[model samples]
Target: MLADMRDEVFDQDRACQALSHDRDRLVEAMDSGVADIDRLTFPDGPLTLLDLAVHVTMWDEINLGVVTLALRGRPHWSLDPRWETAEAGGALNVGGVRAGRGLTEELIRHRFHAVRQAHIDTIAEIPRSQWEQELPFAHSGSQPRTLGGLCHYVNTPEADPTRKLTYQHAAVHLGATSLSRAAPTGTG
Candidate 1:
């Protein structure tokens, strides 16, 4: 299964494109209400919608950071800890889910949009050759995931991918059906 996932990661460009498209649909879906966001039970306990948003945002930012590093061959400047603290502090609005509080709907939308755009830019800038490079024993638990691995996870189905995918897949699966109406006929 890991090997298959590796093959999928090699198709990073496709994964990036898919992720960007899915993110757009997710943002649109979220426009309905905070309740639209999925919930998960964290080890700490049950997570609220706001908590789920923060969790998703964190994963997206981390993936974006990894992709940026892979493309640029260096790390970008990190945001100030204060900003993180502030964001965390506001996580109480949705019953301490660490999301849906302190932030207006528009602000949440813009933040997600910016993250998605950054991912697109990173994907566009990275060369295919770079993505194929092997970094054996370089990625473990603490280190960032390799570009190839990240890409694969995005495009391929997993027995149980990260929770992030559960939220994203819901949006994409729905959008694919809706958007099919706009596709050229005789293709499906």
Candidate 2:
């Protein structure tokens, strides 16, 4: 059992490391400060480079909360949109906005490290028993989802629409911002 648990947890650790490493490489690619990225835009509405940075932290916070609850063997939790909107406001209050408004490239990089570490700690602390258990996504899907599965998916270069979209999002922010020689070393 212990051996099996190690394998399960190790995948998650590797996935996390890859994500962090990618972000770290992004920092390297960003030769200029936040001012350089101020014009960062999404083809979609209302999303900027700052919004992407803040959303990453916000989702990290949300994922930690939901996964923690699930690991504790609690019922699936619901995230209030009102609560999320308010939280976004707070992110802005801190240094989540763009160059002159709130955030700097340095600070954004720092928050990514901090929030990603929090996720690493949270995942490490979850018991092995909860790993394969099903976890609810923020929205419903016909497909099933599980804690361990999510870890695996993010780490591995699996082909799926959702995964593709996620990588697309990451590319828009991290890829667009900079380029580095860092090849992803983990499942992702």
Candidate 3:
């Protein structure tokens, strides 16, 4: 049973399934909210739906790149010089949001959907056997340094205890709290 569980853990199909499930939840959550994504704003939250879409798409793009590189026997260490450091992640998010401003609402939505599809498609390309292959870079602590681990880490937020199985980052952004909040004063 241990071997079966281990096999399932690193299986490409399982990884894609988890990713697709979270993406569906996020899309459903977004669809049920304010119809005008350009005007969808959260009270006390820094991002509008447009901004949030850009931010999420940016991370998806990054994940796609990382997985693509790993598949080619390359290390993703230089994708961000300080990618391994949690403190630097906020800056990356901030920069993505800033850079994505001025994009049309339609374009932002399109990119978000397209990039997510590409990310899942890329993950599906990883072979079952190589899913557990250790990545070239050194991982923090005993966290699995395999290809599956990289995908799991990028998808799951630091605060989530469930780790490998959930997309807590998407939940943090598109969850009930974010959906229910009223727009902050003076912003749309």
Task: List, residue by residue over 1-188, the lDDT tens digit for candidate 2.
Answer: 01222123234555455456644544444434342232333333455444555555655655667666656555334334453354543543244333323667577767766876777677766666667667745323222356665444333211122232222224434434332223356432
Q: Supply every candidate's count of residue pairs whose N, Cα or C atoms clash at under 3 angstroms.
A: 5, 3, 0
Clashes of 2: 3
Residues 2-21, model 1: lDDT tens digits: 12222323354455555655
Error of 1 at 188 (Å): 19
TM-score of 1: 0.55
- Per-residue lDDT for 110 in model 1? 67
lDDT of each: 0.45, 0.47, 0.61
Best by lDDT: 3
Compute the lDDT for candidate 3: 0.61
Candidate 1 accuracy as lDDT: 0.45
Error of 1 at 161 (Å): 5.5
Cα lDDT for residue 55, candidate 2: 52
RMSD value for candidate 3: 9.0
Rank candidates, TM-score, best first.
3, 1, 2
lDDT of 3 by residue, 1-188 (tens): 01112112335665566556556656665677653332223343566666777877887887788788878878666345577565566677677787788788788878988998898788887777788888777544234778887676566554333342333345555543232111122311
